[model samples]
Target: MRLARQRAHALIAKSPADAVRSVFDLMENLPEVERLRPSEVGLVLVRGRVGGEGERFNLGELPVARAALRIPEGPVGVGYVAGRNRDHAELAALADAMVQADVWRDRLEEGVLAPLAAGLAERKADTGRKAAATKVDFFTMVRTRGEK
Candidate 1:
C-alpha cells in the first residue's frame, strides 16, 4: 500500500496538472475541503541501517512536501511526497482524502490510480528492456593438465 502511494506520488509529482485534470474528470464535484495543513516543503532526516539490520545512522536529509486536508464531515487525508511540488502535494492530499472516503475510492482508484500505475509499469518495463540490452555474460575457461 505504501508502494502504491509512493507510485501515486511519483506520478503526481511528475505532472501535477495532468493529475488534477484526471481527478476533475473522474469526479463531478468535491465536497468542501479544508486544509488541515497547507502544502509545505521541508526536510526530513533519512536514517538507514547497515544491510537492513544494524545500528541506524543518519543518511541525509531529503526534501519533501506534505499536505493534510479534510473534506467537511469526512475523513482527513495526508500526502507526503518527495520534492517541493505544492500542486502535487495538494492533489495527492485530495486523493488521500478520497481514498478514505470510501464513496469516492472506486472512482479515484479507477480514474487516477489505474492510469498512473499503468504508466509506471510501462516505464519500468522500458527500463528493464534497456538494462537487459546492455547485459553481458562472462565465461571462465577451464585448463587441462597439459594445457598451456
Candidate 2:
C-alpha cells in the first residue's frame, strides 16, 4: 500500500485535478470518505543542494496543497501534492485512503496509477529527447611541440 500511496501522490502532482475525476466517475461503487482536514493551500520552503553534494540551502518557497482524509471503515490518509489545487489534494488523499483498503487497491492502481505512470513516462521521454538534441560535447587534444 505504501507503493500505491507514493504513486498516487506523484500522479496527483503530475496530472491535473480534473484527470482524477474521470477515474472515480467510472467506478460504479465509490467508497465513503470523510475529509478530516479539507484540502488547504500554503507555502513551504523548498530546500536544495547547490551541486547535489554542496551545502543545503533554502532554494525558494513553493505553493503546496495538502489534504487529510479518513475512511471510517479503514485507515486515515494524508496527501501532500505540489501546486495549489485543492481538488487535486483532496482526490489524492481519497486515493491514498482507498489504496489502504484491500479491495480497492488493485482497481485504483489499474484505473488510476497505471495510466498516470504511462503519461508521466511519455512526458519524461519527450523532454529527454528534446534535451538530447541540443546536447554538446567538448574534448581537449594535447599537441606536443614538434620541429617543422
Q: Best candidate, lDDT-wise?
A: 2
For each candidate in turn, the TM-score is 0.80, 0.83
Once fitted onto the true fold, the runs of candidate 2 whose alpha carbons sit more than 4 angstroms away are: 140-144
Candidate 2 whole-model C-alpha lDDT, 0 to 1: 0.81
lDDT tens readout by residue for model 2, 32-59: 8888866899999999996789799999
What TM-score would candidate 1 get against the native?
0.80
Best by TM-score: 2
Which sections of candidate 1 miss by over 4 Å?
1-27
Candidate 1, residues 1-148, lDDT tens digits: the string is: 5655555556666544565566556666676789986689999999999999979999999998889899864878788778777777778888777767758777777788778767667878999999999999999999999889
State the weakest 10-residue window (summed lDDT) of model 2. 16-25
Question: Against the true structure, what is every candidate's RMSD?
Answer: 3.4, 2.4
